[model samples]
Target: MAKKCLGVREDTGDPCKRPAGSRSDFCFAHRPQEGNEKILNLQHDPYHCPDDGQKLWYVPRLKLHRCGMCDGVLLNEKEIDPLVLESVLGLSKVAEEGLAVECPTCSTDSDLSDGKFALSNFAMEWGFAVQKSKYHSVYYCGVSNVGHCKVCGSTWFAGPGERDALGKNVGKERGFWRVQPGGSKIWGPLDMQQRLREERLRLVARKTEKRERMREKLCQHVDSNGERCNRRKTQKEGSEYCFKHRPK
Candidate 1:
Protein backbone atom coordinates (compact mmCIF):
# COMPACT_ATOMS: atom_id res chain seq x y z
CA MET A 1 0.00 0.00 0.00
CA ALA A 2 1.06 3.55 -0.69
CA LYS A 3 2.10 5.70 2.30
CA LYS A 4 -0.40 8.33 3.44
CA CYS A 5 -0.04 11.48 5.56
CA LEU A 6 -0.33 10.85 9.28
CA GLY A 7 -1.38 14.44 9.92
CA VAL A 8 -5.00 15.51 10.42
CA ARG A 9 -6.58 18.35 8.42
CA GLU A 10 -7.23 21.47 10.44
CA ASP A 11 -9.97 22.86 8.16
CA THR A 12 -12.13 19.76 7.59
CA GLY A 13 -11.61 18.08 10.95
CA ASP A 14 -10.57 14.91 9.10
CA PRO A 15 -7.37 13.00 8.70
CA CYS A 16 -5.10 14.47 6.07
CA LYS A 17 -4.97 11.77 3.44
CA ARG A 18 -2.30 13.30 1.19
CA PRO A 19 0.92 11.41 0.64
CA ALA A 20 3.67 12.00 3.19
CA GLY A 21 6.81 13.80 2.13
CA SER A 22 9.60 11.57 0.92
CA ARG A 23 12.20 13.11 3.29
CA SER A 24 9.90 13.87 6.22
CA ASP A 25 7.47 11.74 8.27
CA PHE A 26 4.64 14.27 7.70
CA CYS A 27 3.16 15.82 4.52
CA PHE A 28 4.32 19.22 3.19
CA ALA A 29 1.64 21.06 5.16
CA HIS A 30 2.18 19.13 8.38
CA ARG A 31 5.96 19.34 8.51
CA PRO A 32 7.41 21.05 11.60
CA GLN A 33 5.91 24.56 11.80
CA GLU A 34 9.32 26.13 11.25
CA GLY A 35 10.16 26.86 7.53
CA ASN A 36 6.92 25.10 6.49
CA GLU A 37 6.18 27.55 3.65
CA LYS A 38 5.00 26.11 0.30
CA ILE A 39 7.23 26.38 -2.76
CA LEU A 40 5.47 27.57 -5.99
CA ASN A 41 7.39 27.61 -9.27
CA LEU A 42 6.84 27.84 -13.03
CA GLN A 43 6.52 24.70 -15.15
CA HIS A 44 9.08 23.91 -17.86
CA ASP A 45 6.16 22.69 -20.02
CA PRO A 46 2.64 24.01 -20.40
CA TYR A 47 0.02 22.48 -17.98
CA HIS A 48 2.72 20.52 -16.16
CA CYS A 49 5.13 21.23 -13.31
CA PRO A 50 8.85 21.15 -14.14
CA ASP A 51 10.03 20.13 -10.64
CA ASP A 52 7.56 17.25 -10.10
CA GLY A 53 6.33 16.65 -13.69
CA GLN A 54 2.77 16.52 -12.28
CA LYS A 55 -0.07 17.87 -14.39
CA LEU A 56 -1.77 20.99 -13.02
CA TRP A 57 -5.49 20.68 -12.35
CA TYR A 58 -6.96 23.98 -13.50
CA VAL A 59 -9.47 25.51 -15.90
CA PRO A 60 -7.59 28.17 -17.85
CA ARG A 61 -10.73 29.99 -19.00
CA LEU A 62 -12.56 29.80 -15.64
CA LYS A 63 -9.70 30.82 -13.30
CA LEU A 64 -10.33 27.62 -11.34
CA HIS A 65 -6.91 26.23 -10.73
CA ARG A 66 -5.07 23.74 -8.54
CA CYS A 67 -1.68 22.11 -8.64
CA GLY A 68 -1.52 18.33 -8.73
CA MET A 69 1.74 17.89 -6.79
CA CYS A 70 3.76 21.00 -6.00
CA ASP A 71 0.77 23.28 -5.31
CA GLY A 72 2.21 25.76 -7.83
CA VAL A 73 0.71 27.76 -10.71
CA LEU A 74 1.58 26.29 -14.14
CA LEU A 75 -0.48 28.62 -16.35
CA ASN A 76 -2.12 31.93 -15.44
CA GLU A 77 -2.23 33.98 -18.69
CA LYS A 78 -5.69 32.99 -19.99
CA GLU A 79 -8.69 35.32 -19.49
CA ILE A 80 -11.68 34.04 -17.47
CA ASP A 81 -15.11 33.38 -19.04
CA PRO A 82 -18.04 33.28 -16.66
CA LEU A 83 -20.47 31.77 -19.20
CA VAL A 84 -18.02 29.10 -20.15
CA LEU A 85 -17.40 28.34 -16.50
CA GLU A 86 -21.15 28.08 -15.85
CA SER A 87 -21.50 25.68 -18.78
CA VAL A 88 -18.59 23.63 -17.51
CA LEU A 89 -19.93 23.51 -13.96
CA GLY A 90 -23.53 22.88 -15.15
CA LEU A 91 -24.86 25.68 -12.93
CA SER A 92 -28.09 26.33 -14.82
CA LYS A 93 -31.48 25.86 -13.14
CA VAL A 94 -32.58 23.61 -16.00
CA ALA A 95 -29.87 21.14 -15.15
CA GLU A 96 -30.79 21.21 -11.46
CA GLU A 97 -34.52 20.70 -12.06
CA GLY A 98 -33.92 17.82 -14.45
CA LEU A 99 -32.77 15.68 -11.51
CA ALA A 100 -35.72 16.52 -9.29
CA VAL A 101 -37.77 13.40 -9.92
CA GLU A 102 -37.00 10.72 -7.32
CA CYS A 103 -37.89 7.06 -7.56
CA PRO A 104 -40.83 6.21 -5.30
CA THR A 105 -39.36 2.93 -4.19
CA CYS A 106 -35.69 3.83 -3.77
CA SER A 107 -35.97 7.56 -3.27
CA THR A 108 -33.11 7.91 -5.68
CA ASP A 109 -33.18 11.00 -7.88
CA SER A 110 -32.86 10.85 -11.66
CA ASP A 111 -32.30 13.44 -14.31
CA LEU A 112 -35.11 13.67 -16.90
CA SER A 113 -33.53 16.14 -19.27
CA ASP A 114 -30.47 15.08 -21.22
CA GLY A 115 -31.19 11.63 -19.87
CA LYS A 116 -29.89 8.79 -22.02
CA PHE A 117 -32.62 6.48 -20.67
CA ALA A 118 -35.99 7.68 -19.41
CA LEU A 119 -39.40 6.43 -18.36
CA SER A 120 -42.16 7.38 -20.79
CA ASN A 121 -45.89 7.19 -20.19
CA PHE A 122 -47.73 4.73 -22.43
CA ALA A 123 -51.52 4.48 -22.50
CA MET A 124 -53.76 1.78 -24.02
CA GLU A 125 -57.40 2.56 -24.65
CA TRP A 126 -60.44 0.22 -24.64
CA GLY A 127 -64.21 0.63 -24.79
CA PHE A 128 -66.51 -0.47 -21.94
CA ALA A 129 -68.39 -3.75 -22.71
CA VAL A 130 -71.97 -2.44 -22.08
CA GLN A 131 -71.41 1.30 -22.34
CA LYS A 132 -69.49 3.87 -24.34
CA SER A 133 -67.23 4.72 -21.44
CA LYS A 134 -63.63 5.13 -22.52
CA TYR A 135 -61.06 3.33 -20.48
CA HIS A 136 -57.31 3.34 -20.58
CA SER A 137 -54.38 2.24 -18.51
CA VAL A 138 -50.80 3.42 -18.27
CA TYR A 139 -47.88 1.06 -18.06
CA TYR A 140 -44.20 1.59 -17.40
CA CYS A 141 -41.72 -1.23 -17.76
CA GLY A 142 -37.98 -1.51 -17.14
CA VAL A 143 -37.46 -2.27 -20.83
CA SER A 144 -39.24 0.92 -21.78
CA ASN A 145 -38.29 3.28 -18.98
CA VAL A 146 -34.90 3.71 -17.36
CA GLY A 147 -36.73 3.81 -14.06
CA HIS A 148 -35.02 0.76 -12.60
CA CYS A 149 -33.43 1.79 -9.30
CA LYS A 150 -29.93 0.63 -8.63
CA VAL A 151 -30.14 1.25 -4.88
CA CYS A 152 -33.34 -0.67 -4.09
CA GLY A 153 -33.45 -2.98 -7.10
CA SER A 154 -36.98 -1.79 -7.78
CA THR A 155 -38.80 -1.56 -11.09
CA TRP A 156 -41.59 1.01 -11.00
CA PHE A 157 -44.50 0.29 -13.33
CA ALA A 158 -48.03 1.64 -13.42
CA GLY A 159 -50.79 -0.70 -14.56
CA PRO A 160 -53.64 0.32 -16.82
CA GLY A 161 -56.18 2.40 -14.91
CA GLU A 162 -57.00 5.98 -13.96
CA ARG A 163 -53.87 7.61 -12.69
CA ASP A 164 -52.55 11.04 -11.83
CA ALA A 165 -49.54 12.72 -13.41
CA LEU A 166 -47.41 11.33 -10.61
CA GLY A 167 -48.11 7.79 -11.92
CA LYS A 168 -50.47 6.83 -9.10
CA ASN A 169 -53.26 4.49 -10.27
CA VAL A 170 -56.72 5.40 -8.93
CA GLY A 171 -59.05 3.10 -10.91
CA LYS A 172 -59.83 -0.61 -11.25
CA GLU A 173 -56.77 -2.83 -11.15
CA ARG A 174 -55.29 0.59 -10.86
CA GLY A 175 -52.05 0.34 -9.04
CA PHE A 176 -48.35 0.00 -9.51
CA TRP A 177 -46.10 -2.99 -9.42
CA ARG A 178 -43.21 -3.04 -6.94
CA VAL A 179 -40.98 -5.82 -8.09
CA GLN A 180 -39.02 -7.55 -5.32
CA PRO A 181 -35.54 -6.22 -4.85
CA GLY A 182 -32.95 -8.43 -6.51
CA GLY A 183 -29.91 -8.36 -8.73
CA SER A 184 -29.54 -5.58 -11.22
CA LYS A 185 -30.33 -6.15 -14.90
CA ILE A 186 -27.59 -4.77 -17.07
CA TRP A 187 -28.32 -6.78 -20.21
CA GLY A 188 -29.80 -5.17 -23.28
CA PRO A 189 -33.14 -6.18 -24.78
CA LEU A 190 -31.55 -8.41 -27.37
CA ASP A 191 -29.35 -10.12 -24.78
CA MET A 192 -32.28 -10.73 -22.41
CA GLN A 193 -34.36 -12.15 -25.27
CA GLN A 194 -31.53 -14.45 -26.28
CA ARG A 195 -31.08 -15.61 -22.69
CA LEU A 196 -34.79 -16.41 -22.36
CA ARG A 197 -34.70 -18.44 -25.56
CA GLU A 198 -31.62 -20.34 -24.39
CA GLU A 199 -33.30 -21.13 -21.05
CA ARG A 200 -36.40 -22.48 -22.82
CA LEU A 201 -34.26 -24.63 -25.08
CA ARG A 202 -32.41 -26.05 -22.08
CA LEU A 203 -35.69 -26.93 -20.35
CA VAL A 204 -36.91 -28.68 -23.49
CA ALA A 205 -33.65 -30.61 -23.76
CA ARG A 206 -33.94 -31.76 -20.12
CA LYS A 207 -37.51 -32.93 -20.62
CA THR A 208 -36.56 -34.83 -23.76
CA GLU A 209 -33.66 -36.53 -21.95
CA LYS A 210 -35.95 -37.55 -19.06
CA ARG A 211 -38.44 -39.11 -21.48
CA GLU A 212 -35.68 -41.02 -23.25
CA ARG A 213 -34.35 -42.39 -19.95
CA MET A 214 -37.88 -43.54 -19.00
CA ARG A 215 -38.18 -45.37 -22.35
CA GLU A 216 -34.84 -47.15 -21.78
CA LYS A 217 -36.02 -48.90 -18.54
CA LEU A 218 -39.38 -50.14 -19.79
CA CYS A 219 -40.74 -53.71 -19.53
CA GLN A 220 -38.66 -56.27 -21.45
CA HIS A 221 -41.17 -59.18 -21.31
CA VAL A 222 -41.33 -61.68 -24.19
CA ASP A 223 -44.39 -63.75 -25.20
CA SER A 224 -44.35 -67.57 -25.44
CA ASN A 225 -41.40 -68.51 -27.70
CA GLY A 226 -41.56 -65.06 -29.33
CA GLU A 227 -39.94 -61.61 -29.54
CA ARG A 228 -39.48 -59.04 -26.80
CA CYS A 229 -42.46 -56.81 -25.86
CA ASN A 230 -41.67 -53.16 -26.64
CA ARG A 231 -44.45 -51.64 -24.49
CA ARG A 232 -43.55 -49.70 -21.30
CA LYS A 233 -46.65 -51.21 -19.64
CA THR A 234 -45.46 -50.95 -16.01
CA GLN A 235 -47.78 -49.03 -13.65
CA LYS A 236 -45.25 -48.60 -10.81
CA GLU A 237 -42.26 -46.29 -11.01
CA GLY A 238 -38.81 -47.90 -11.50
CA SER A 239 -40.40 -51.34 -11.92
CA GLU A 240 -38.91 -53.48 -14.69
CA TYR A 241 -41.91 -55.87 -14.91
CA CYS A 242 -45.20 -55.07 -16.62
CA PHE A 243 -48.43 -55.02 -14.53
CA LYS A 244 -49.48 -58.40 -15.92
CA HIS A 245 -46.14 -60.08 -15.11
CA ARG A 246 -45.48 -58.49 -11.70
CA PRO A 247 -46.20 -60.56 -8.48
CA LYS A 248 -49.56 -59.72 -6.86
Candidate 2:
Protein backbone atom coordinates (compact mmCIF):
# COMPACT_ATOMS: atom_id res chain seq x y z
CA MET A 1 0.00 0.00 0.00
CA ALA A 2 1.21 3.51 -0.83
CA LYS A 3 1.95 5.60 2.29
CA LYS A 4 0.16 8.93 2.86
CA CYS A 5 2.48 11.96 3.42
CA LEU A 6 2.70 12.96 7.05
CA GLY A 7 2.71 16.67 6.29
CA VAL A 8 0.50 19.57 7.42
CA ARG A 9 0.17 23.10 6.14
CA GLU A 10 1.61 25.35 8.83
CA ASP A 11 -0.82 28.17 8.10
CA THR A 12 -4.16 26.30 7.95
CA GLY A 13 -3.11 23.22 9.96
CA ASP A 14 -4.59 21.11 7.18
CA PRO A 15 -3.23 17.63 6.52
CA CYS A 16 -1.21 17.10 3.35
CA LYS A 17 -2.49 13.79 1.84
CA ARG A 18 -0.08 13.58 -1.07
CA PRO A 19 1.87 10.32 -1.48
CA ALA A 20 5.04 10.17 0.63
CA GLY A 21 8.41 10.29 -1.07
CA SER A 22 10.18 6.93 -1.78
CA ARG A 23 12.26 7.08 1.41
CA SER A 24 10.64 9.96 3.38
CA ASP A 25 7.48 10.37 5.46
CA PHE A 26 6.69 13.82 4.05
CA CYS A 27 5.74 14.71 0.49
CA PHE A 28 8.12 16.87 -1.54
CA ALA A 29 6.02 19.93 -0.62
CA HIS A 30 6.37 19.40 3.13
CA ARG A 31 9.92 18.01 3.25
CA PRO A 32 12.11 19.19 6.17
CA GLN A 33 14.97 20.35 3.98
CA GLU A 34 16.59 23.67 4.97
CA GLY A 35 15.45 25.95 2.19
CA ASN A 36 12.27 24.02 1.42
CA GLU A 37 10.36 23.70 4.74
CA LYS A 38 12.03 26.68 6.39
CA ILE A 39 11.28 29.11 3.62
CA LEU A 40 7.83 27.61 3.11
CA ASN A 41 6.92 27.96 6.82
CA LEU A 42 7.97 31.58 6.77
CA GLN A 43 4.98 32.24 4.54
CA HIS A 44 2.59 29.67 6.04
CA ASP A 45 3.25 29.29 9.74
CA PRO A 46 0.32 28.28 12.01
CA TYR A 47 0.52 31.19 14.46
CA HIS A 48 -0.52 34.66 13.35
CA CYS A 49 2.07 37.42 13.37
CA PRO A 50 1.33 39.94 16.08
CA ASP A 51 2.32 42.81 13.82
CA ASP A 52 -0.14 41.97 11.09
CA GLY A 53 -2.12 38.93 12.27
CA GLN A 54 -0.45 36.81 9.57
CA LYS A 55 1.52 33.58 9.83
CA LEU A 56 4.69 33.41 11.95
CA TRP A 57 7.92 31.34 11.92
CA TYR A 58 10.75 30.69 14.32
CA VAL A 59 14.30 29.85 13.28
CA PRO A 60 16.08 28.15 16.21
CA ARG A 61 19.64 28.11 14.91
CA LEU A 62 19.55 31.79 14.05
CA LYS A 63 17.44 32.66 17.11
CA LEU A 64 15.15 34.59 14.76
CA HIS A 65 11.40 34.76 15.35
CA ARG A 66 9.73 36.70 12.57
CA CYS A 67 6.31 37.25 11.06
CA GLY A 68 5.79 35.54 7.75
CA MET A 69 3.22 38.05 6.49
CA CYS A 70 4.74 41.36 7.55
CA ASP A 71 8.36 40.22 7.98
CA GLY A 72 8.48 42.00 11.34
CA VAL A 73 11.31 40.89 13.61
CA LEU A 74 10.17 39.66 17.00
CA LEU A 75 12.59 39.83 19.90
CA ASN A 76 13.84 36.70 21.64
CA GLU A 77 13.54 36.00 25.38
CA LYS A 78 17.07 37.19 26.15
CA GLU A 79 16.52 40.38 24.18
CA ILE A 80 13.19 41.01 25.94
CA ASP A 81 14.58 40.85 29.48
CA PRO A 82 16.28 44.23 29.49
CA LEU A 83 13.14 45.97 28.23
CA VAL A 84 11.04 44.31 30.93
CA LEU A 85 13.45 45.15 33.70
CA GLU A 86 13.68 48.77 32.66
CA SER A 87 9.92 49.17 32.42
CA VAL A 88 9.13 47.47 35.75
CA LEU A 89 11.86 49.35 37.60
CA GLY A 90 10.72 52.70 36.15
CA LEU A 91 13.94 53.40 34.27
CA SER A 92 12.04 55.77 32.01
CA LYS A 93 12.61 58.54 34.54
CA VAL A 94 16.25 58.77 33.54
CA ALA A 95 15.30 59.54 29.96
CA GLU A 96 13.17 62.51 31.02
CA GLU A 97 16.24 64.62 31.67
CA GLY A 98 17.52 63.82 28.21
CA LEU A 99 15.18 66.40 26.72
CA ALA A 100 16.99 69.22 28.48
CA VAL A 101 19.98 68.75 26.23
CA GLU A 102 20.71 70.84 23.18
CA CYS A 103 20.20 69.28 19.76
CA PRO A 104 23.62 68.54 18.28
CA THR A 105 22.30 69.08 14.76
CA CYS A 106 20.68 72.48 15.20
CA SER A 107 22.13 73.57 18.56
CA THR A 108 18.59 74.39 19.68
CA ASP A 109 17.76 73.40 23.22
CA SER A 110 15.07 70.72 23.63
CA ASP A 111 12.38 71.39 26.18
CA LEU A 112 9.55 68.99 27.10
CA SER A 113 7.78 71.54 29.25
CA ASP A 114 4.70 72.29 27.14
CA GLY A 115 2.98 68.94 27.69
CA LYS A 116 5.34 67.30 25.22
CA PHE A 117 6.77 64.50 27.31
CA ALA A 118 10.00 63.18 25.93
CA LEU A 119 9.97 60.09 28.12
CA SER A 120 7.48 58.24 25.98
CA ASN A 121 6.90 54.47 26.17
CA PHE A 122 6.00 51.90 23.53
CA ALA A 123 4.77 48.30 23.39
CA MET A 124 6.91 45.48 22.02
CA GLU A 125 6.72 41.69 21.55
CA TRP A 126 8.85 38.56 21.46
CA GLY A 127 8.21 35.52 19.29
CA PHE A 128 9.50 31.93 19.13
CA ALA A 129 9.34 29.46 16.25
CA VAL A 130 9.59 25.68 16.39
CA GLN A 131 12.72 24.42 14.62
CA LYS A 132 11.14 21.65 12.51
CA SER A 133 7.47 22.49 12.92
CA LYS A 134 5.12 25.37 12.13
CA TYR A 135 4.27 26.11 15.77
CA HIS A 136 5.09 29.64 17.09
CA SER A 137 5.02 31.40 20.44
CA VAL A 138 4.69 35.11 21.15
CA TYR A 139 5.20 36.99 24.39
CA TYR A 140 4.44 40.51 25.49
CA CYS A 141 7.84 42.12 25.18
CA GLY A 142 7.95 45.54 26.93
CA VAL A 143 8.16 49.27 26.53
CA SER A 144 10.73 51.31 24.61
CA ASN A 145 11.38 54.96 23.93
CA VAL A 146 11.41 56.55 20.48
CA GLY A 147 13.90 59.32 20.83
CA HIS A 148 14.03 62.30 18.52
CA CYS A 149 15.47 65.77 18.61
CA LYS A 150 12.55 68.12 19.19
CA VAL A 151 14.26 71.07 17.53
CA CYS A 152 15.36 69.64 14.21
CA GLY A 153 13.21 66.52 13.99
CA SER A 154 16.35 64.36 13.88
CA THR A 155 16.19 60.86 15.30
CA TRP A 156 18.27 59.94 18.35
CA PHE A 157 18.76 57.32 21.05
CA ALA A 158 18.74 58.70 24.55
CA GLY A 159 21.33 57.59 27.07
CA PRO A 160 21.01 57.88 30.85
CA GLY A 161 23.37 60.82 31.07
CA GLU A 162 23.44 64.62 30.77
CA ARG A 163 24.15 64.39 27.06
CA ASP A 164 21.66 64.47 24.17
CA ALA A 165 20.99 61.76 21.62
CA LEU A 166 23.68 63.27 19.43
CA GLY A 167 26.20 62.85 22.26
CA LYS A 168 26.54 66.58 22.78
CA ASN A 169 27.08 67.62 26.38
CA VAL A 170 23.97 69.04 28.07
CA GLY A 171 23.34 72.07 30.31
CA LYS A 172 26.58 73.73 29.23
CA GLU A 173 26.58 77.24 27.80
CA ARG A 174 28.60 78.08 24.70
CA GLY A 175 30.30 81.40 24.26
CA PHE A 176 33.60 83.15 24.08
CA TRP A 177 35.24 83.96 27.47
CA ARG A 178 32.50 83.69 29.85
CA VAL A 179 35.42 81.31 30.01
CA GLN A 180 37.35 82.12 33.14
CA PRO A 181 40.92 83.31 32.85
CA GLY A 182 43.38 80.37 32.78
CA GLY A 183 40.70 78.01 31.57
CA SER A 184 41.20 76.44 28.16
CA LYS A 185 39.31 78.76 25.84
CA ILE A 186 39.51 78.43 22.09
CA TRP A 187 40.82 81.55 20.41
CA GLY A 188 38.58 83.26 17.86
CA PRO A 189 39.75 83.89 14.30
CA LEU A 190 40.93 87.51 14.86
CA ASP A 191 42.36 86.63 18.25
CA MET A 192 44.31 83.78 16.68
CA GLN A 193 45.70 86.08 14.02
CA GLN A 194 46.73 88.59 16.70
CA ARG A 195 48.51 85.85 18.58
CA LEU A 196 50.34 84.77 15.42
CA ARG A 197 51.43 88.39 14.83
CA GLU A 198 52.73 88.71 18.38
CA GLU A 199 54.66 85.46 18.03
CA ARG A 200 56.22 86.66 14.80
CA LEU A 201 57.26 89.99 16.38
CA ARG A 202 58.79 88.20 19.36
CA LEU A 203 60.76 85.88 17.06
CA VAL A 204 61.99 88.83 14.99
CA ALA A 205 63.18 90.61 18.14
CA ARG A 206 65.13 87.54 19.25
CA LYS A 207 66.74 87.24 15.83
CA THR A 208 67.68 90.97 15.89
CA GLU A 209 69.23 90.53 19.33
CA LYS A 210 71.30 87.55 18.04
CA ARG A 211 72.57 89.59 15.08
CA GLU A 212 73.63 92.48 17.39
CA ARG A 213 75.57 90.03 19.56
CA MET A 214 77.39 88.72 16.47
CA ARG A 215 78.24 92.33 15.35
CA GLU A 216 79.55 93.16 18.86
CA LYS A 217 82.03 90.22 18.55
CA LEU A 218 83.48 91.57 15.22
CA CYS A 219 87.29 91.51 14.74
CA GLN A 220 89.22 94.65 15.87
CA HIS A 221 91.97 94.16 13.22
CA VAL A 222 92.51 97.17 10.86
CA ASP A 223 92.38 96.51 7.11
CA SER A 224 94.18 98.15 4.14
CA ASN A 225 91.43 100.79 4.00
CA GLY A 226 92.15 101.70 7.65
CA GLU A 227 88.86 100.12 8.69
CA ARG A 228 88.48 97.58 11.49
CA CYS A 229 88.00 94.02 10.10
CA ASN A 230 84.30 93.19 10.00
CA ARG A 231 85.06 89.48 10.62
CA ARG A 232 83.99 87.81 13.89
CA LYS A 233 86.71 87.57 16.56
CA THR A 234 87.51 83.87 17.16
CA GLN A 235 91.30 84.13 18.05
CA LYS A 236 92.91 82.99 21.34
CA GLU A 237 94.91 84.99 23.93
CA GLY A 238 95.74 88.29 22.13
CA SER A 239 94.73 87.94 18.44
CA GLU A 240 91.85 90.09 17.12
CA TYR A 241 90.46 88.53 13.85
CA CYS A 242 88.71 85.24 13.10
CA PHE A 243 91.28 82.46 12.30
CA LYS A 244 91.20 83.13 8.55
CA HIS A 245 91.31 87.02 8.78
CA ARG A 246 93.85 87.38 11.59
CA PRO A 247 97.18 89.22 10.92
CA LYS A 248 99.35 86.46 9.34
- TM, every model: 0.19, 0.22
What digit string (tens of lDDT, one per residue) describes model 2 on residues 1-248? 77876565554334566888888767887776334554455444443332244444444433334443333333323523343334323322333553343222232133334534232322111111113345753111111232333334432222122332223332322211112111222222333334533554555566678878887688877778898777778758766678778767
- Assess the local accuracy of residue 16 in candidate 2 as a C-alpha lDDT between 0 and 100: 64
- lDDT on C-alpha atoms for all candidate structures: 0.35, 0.40
Measured by TM-score, how close is model 1 to the native structure?
A: 0.19
Task: Name the lDDT of candidate 1.
Answer: 0.35
- Pick out the ten consecutive residues of candidate 2 with the lowest summed lDDT: 173-182
Q: List the residue pairs that clash in candidate 1.
A: 137-160, 137-161
Candidate achieving the largest TM-score: 2
Determine which window of 10 residues in candidate 1 has minimal summed lDDT.
175-184
Off by over 4 Å in 2: 1-45, 78-248
